[model samples]
Target: MTAAAPSATMRLIEASTMISQGAEAKIYRARLHPPAASSPSDPSAPDGCVLLKHRFAKQYRHPTLDGALTRARVAGEARALVRCLRAGVRVPGVRMVDAAAGVLGIEWVDGASVRALLGGGAEGEVEVEERDDGEEEEGEEEAHEDGAEVALREYGLTPDQVMEMIGAELAKMHRADVVHGDLTTSNMMLRRPSAAQPAAELVLIDFGLAYISTLPEDKAVDLYVLERAFASTHPQSEPLFAGVLNAYAKGMGKDWTPVSRRLDDVRLRGRKRSMVG
Candidate 1:
């Protein structure tokens, strides 16, 4: 007796486990079985499952506008992932794309997020003790260091080494003209080394906000956003970030000078350039 044909995306979604959700999309983990072979003796079976990101419909916006935005964003993200892969950047591979339905399936990464490896917990869900003005308390650096020790042991990486990896990877992406609009630790992952591969690789994910640009200002703002994230989340991350910049400088080669200068200027003025005189 033969079985019915697989429903591809629908079947994958039905069997998938909802992993996470954000304002823009929901992610799931599931097996993306290949289309049935035309020949019985074919030898092209895929090994395993993939991660699916579905940009579900938004009811807040007008129906036509919502549909257009979802389709465009899905296609844009898929294109960015393909561009990064071709540029030798370690990002998840594109497995499937359904822009009409706003679904993208990509290679599943089997590891923890960089934020979790840095002792920030999954999704960096640390409780921020608030001051009178709602700013986080300033004395949590000591506690952060203590937690980081255990986290470092689990991942077998020192704080300096992690910073260096982050910097080098970002430089490569910038060289490829891919600007990751969101450069948070949460968007990066350290893939676990497999039997076939000895060394763990750092991968950048979540390209929904990514775009192609060679502008130094855009690159500077990318680094600035990361710098601010570290300041807020990791407490006393100056030396670590400095190590990142050192590796980044070497990776960026001659292009490092302008980006470094622009980064400084950006720091002084904050992320936004004032429109009014």
Candidate 2:
């Protein structure tokens, strides 16, 4: 849906469009233009557009608990994304936060999800027959960094490359003491730097389920979740996953050893700790 025209106070005036509606929140796309030199400056100096995640009040939840949880999660997500950005991990920058309102505005990314970039799962490819028969296919094929369907048919990137990007980006996030609780392929996006640029980079998003923890166990479990996601979604993902771990190992430096050992143990036992009364 379109937002009304901008008022004096709204940075995102005319910038709001719904992205998704979930049990907890509704996401909106907010267009944030760089302030004209004459406009009043914000400390953040927000330029370009951003994705605004507004956690709506859940009538079903107990008001007190809902308010507390919603506020906590909004803050947690903003904090994690900010930490990842500071760590040089490719994450959307937080431009504004209204924790009480459960609103978090982040850098608007231009790309496709890693899942769509990789041709996997029930999500099918684009119809090739739709193309004009006389028109030749466009340009040299490059690796699809955006997601599955486009990545496979259009970008021509192999599964291994996607895995490597996943590994490296996760490692970077972990090194910053951030743990992405829901480490799924769908949560990550591949960002093309520019239309003319050949290179593309991985961007971690959806921090609503994330938190900060420096513990090796937490980090290992994070990797384990991603590994499980890869194995279940893509066939013959062992070597591809190994490549991710390798890149992660190199990027993690001294912190890699402990987390690596814990990851092996987690693989043997599974994601959760055994419960004993």
Candidate 3:
């Protein structure tokens, strides 16, 4: 879907910081403080922050079709996120939804994208940790002089652990019947829970291409796509992907057998279904 460039009319009022931009949407970190309800007991929600994803219209597509497509995707993404949240999966909560304007606002999560966390060659200080004073702490590690290989070390996770998180999260998503059509590390994020919490949280984001599916083949294809992504991006990915599947299998329990076999067949035939006569 083609979305138009962001408009001031549609722009989020309190989005003071621009986080990232891609072909389809622009992400902004913003605070959303809605008016208090009639009840005095309803305490004001102070500085309720969120991520505003504005799906800008694409100039490439016809105007009529573009608007319709953009609106649909925005709505779909918001719905998918809500579905995952209700299923006990770790996804940002939907703070607001404006389907007509092609905007899906979600709770702003403080964390690093799985891509940035894994491919850590980024230059400059990174906001890796938060302090008690409400300031983000920068990573003090020196930049890798090797360039490309530097970022790989920033993830703080071994390849095996990364794979396990991927596997377990995907299994939960699939079991809940959510199919993330784009299953890449870039779409996931790793965030440390609040100071009260210890273990890190794996959050699945960007559900623009997500849908609900119960088919074993669909689930298998999701894993296949992720496996290919890891192999292409990271060196020595076999063991890593194996670890992912181990976690997935454990999460899927009895439902994993069929999907595992299907994945093996998919690997042999390649990502596409054969169209031969």
As a TM-score, model 1 comes out at 0.84
Model 1, range 100-159, lDDT digits (tens) per residue? 778999998877787777766666476446679866567676676667666666556777
Instruction: Estimate, for each residue in 56-145, the C-alpha lDDT of model 3 and write its tens digit.
Output: 788999989999998889888988898898888888899888877778888766666766655432323332343798553443222321
In Å, residue 190's CA in model 2 sits off its true spot by: 0.5
Q: Number of the top candidate by TM-score?
A: 1
- For model 3, the stretches where C-alpha displacement exceeds 4 angstroms are 1-15, 34-47, 120-159, 271-277
Model 2 spans with C-alpha error above 4 angstroms: 1-15, 33-47, 121-158, 195-198, 236-238, 271-277
User: Model 2 compared with the native: what TM-score?
Assistant: 0.74
Error of 2 at 220 (Å): 0.7
**Backbone clashes under 3 angstroms, per model:** 0, 9, 8
Instruction: Sort the candidates on lDDT, descending order.
Output: 1, 2, 3
lDDT of 2 by residue, 153-253 (tens): 44445567766777789888998889999887778887755555467777889988888898999999999888887765553334567888888998899
Whole-model lDDT values for every prediction: 0.82, 0.73, 0.73
Pairs of residues clashing in candidate 2 = 50-108, 116-147, 116-148, 117-147, 117-148, 118-147, 118-148, 119-148, 142-155
